[model samples]
Target: MAEIEVYTERYEREHGHKPVGRRFWSFTIVSPIATAKDHFLHTEQAMTYDKALEKAMEVAIKRRSERIIVEP
Candidate 1:
């Protein structure tokens, strides 16, 4: 099976928090077999990059494991 790849990006928006605003982190999981035109299997957002990445990895593992199971 191909390994799943995780990508993260940080976005800042205007809000009432810090001087520059708040920073939001988003994560996207890309399948190894996916093409440029293909969409990511999962996407998630969190207050911190680590949290977002953790969630993304969890989802990716779950999805990959499910694909390996046989339905009776």
Candidate 2:
């Protein structure tokens, strides 16, 4: 239903000592559509914070984005 362009660059936070052999992945998703009315970012002006978050999660689920494993 909702879609976003995810950045290839991944950010990570190391959880030292507390958890071993566990990795964290952070991804940034941006809107692909650019419009003059929305001032370039359609997703921001078109949807509320809750709505945008919901859509982002939906997109992630649909794409099975959690399966991604990046190696340093």
Candidate 3:
């Protein structure tokens, strides 16, 4: 897997709380829905710490939004 580094501020906007330091990741994924002309659509998500991760995961599916994962 390829790993990308990002800032806490960006992570916070996607997630909620501002991250401490450089703890953001980005993964490029190809979209299957796009056609030949459109190609793939890029999607991004951010992760926070453990407490936030748990809550984010639990409600993510229902909420239909990307969330963050953090250390416990």
lDDT leader: 1
All models: lDDT?
0.37, 0.34, 0.35
Over the stretch 1-72, how does candidate 3's per-residue lDDT look in tens digits?
Answer: 222222245556766775443333332222333334432112234444443334434433333333323321
lDDT of 2 by residue, 1-72 (tens): 333333322323332222123233222332233233322112334444345445555545554343222212
Candidate 1 has its poorest 10 consecutive residues by lDDT at 63-72
Q: Residue 59, candidate 3: how far off, in angstroms?
A: 1.4
> Higher-lDDT candidate among 2 and 3?
3
How would you encode candidate 1's per-residue C-alpha lDDT over 1-72 as one tens digit per residue? 656543211222233232122234433434444354432432333244455445556655755522211001
Preferred candidate (TM-score higher): 1 or 2: 1
- Model 1 residue 22 CA deviation (Å) reads 7.0
Question: Which regions of candidate 3 fall more than 4 Å away from where they truly are?
Answer: 1-9, 12-48, 66-72
Clashes of each: 0, 0, 7
Residue 6 local lDDT, model 3: 22
Q: Estimate each model's TM-score.
A: 0.37, 0.31, 0.26
What 10-residue stretch in candidate 3 is worst by lDDT?
A: 34-43
